[model samples]
Target: MSDRLVIENLQVSYGSGAQRVEAVAPMSLAVPAGQKLGIVGESGSGKSTLLKAVLGLIRPPGVVRADGIWLDGTDLRSLSRREFRARCGSEIAMIFQDPVNALNPAFSIRDQFRRSFRLHQPDLPRSRYTETMLRALASVSIDARDKLGRYPFEFSQGQLQRIMIALACSSPRLKVLLADEPTSSLDVTTQAQVLDLLHALQAELGFSLIIVTHNLPVVAELCDRALVMCRGEVVEDTDVISLFEQPTHDYTRHLLASMASLPRIASGAAS
Candidate 1:
């Protein structure tokens, strides 16, 4: 299959001159259609910055410069901000790390879904919208009728994450899912459940995935290929099995060693 997303010489920097800092050095990557790729890095390794740049979310004083960012043959950099926002969730959706903070505390679940639908499917009738929302929730094993009236604070973290997943996948135009540290805040069993849900949804929907995380086990479980980044640059790129079995970069080896020292916990195990 053709590449679903392609990024070339992507760079991000904050501030000017004396105060400037490079958050992400020049880098290039490609994600083929329906493939899952993991980006593993420590906290300051520019993983989040890279994701933000790709999403066109970088604010003033934080500059994003790239030779090209193409999504299925369309050049993203050429699109206006309004054009980008229109395409964002439908063409490329993002699932943030903190579901609670990502959601509006004052809005009910149905309200949130309505806002999303407005952006992507403004002409959709009310009945159709409700039906679509309910079906999306059901895909993640959530009961829309019972949960739609509740605020973000009412649900457990795991449920909120599942809801976010549902929202991301609801659009028929969705081609790529960008997940940034998506399972970091959840408990062990909930983390496993979310991962399983992501895998199942990807299988059923056929969207490409780019998961940004520091967790090696998460990558191993869900990704076929992995990229290891350190100090604002990609140090290694290899298939998931080879990354763990014979990491070439020193930093990759260190990361593997760190993971090795942690206690082994099976997926879905009680915390």
Candidate 2:
């Protein structure tokens, strides 16, 4: 399959001169079309930073340098800010680490969706905004009637995460879904639900999924290929089975050992 997303010679850094910190070392990788790829690492390993660079969310005093960042066949680096925004809106989406932070405490759910619709679909009829959002909510089993007038704080974390997922994948044009620590804050059962939802969405939507997480089991279950990173560098990039059974790097082994329990995955993520 062709690559849906491509990164070549990418690096992210903070500060400058003697104080400069390389959050992500120069590296390249690709997310295969209609496949799920996992990036696993400990905290400070630059896993999340890499995702930020890809999403164009990094700002000064942070810097992003890349030879090419292509979505479909377009190099995102060549686009202007407005162009980049439009392309990302239609071709890519990101699920942040925390839904609590992603959602607003002050805005009604309707208002939240309203803002998003205005940004991505400005010409969309205002009357259909809620209708569109409601349909997305239904996809995640959220049965809302009348309208989404409730606040984010009113929902459980799990529900909030589902809502966020619904929001992220709402774009029918989405080609790549980039998720960062999606289940990090959820409890075990909630985590399972979120993972399952992502899997189902992938099957239905047929988009390439790139998940950035520290959890080995999450990667094993959901991803076909895994890339291990440490201190801003790609340590190992291989199929998930090889990543677990025969990690080529000491850091990968140490990470496996550090986990409280080794992954129980026999093969792939649970259906």
lDDT of 2 at 24: 96
Q: Which ten residues in a row have the lowest lDDT in candidate 1?
A: 262-271
Model 1 residue 119 distance off true place after TM-score fit, in angstroms: 0.3
Model 2 ranges off by over 4 Å = 260-269
Best by lDDT: 1
Worst 10-residue lDDT window, candidate 2: 260-269
152 Cα displacement, candidate 2 (Å): 1.0
Best by TM-score: 1
Write model 2 residue lDDT over 35-54, tens digit each, in one string.
89999988898988998898
Clashing pairs in 1: none
lDDT of 1 at 166: 95
Question: What are the C-alpha RMSDs, in order, of all predicted structures?
Answer: 2.0, 2.2
Tell me the tens digit of each residue's lDDT in model 1 across 186-250.
Answer: 98778888888898888889999999977787788889999999989999989999999999999
lDDT of 2 at 128: 82
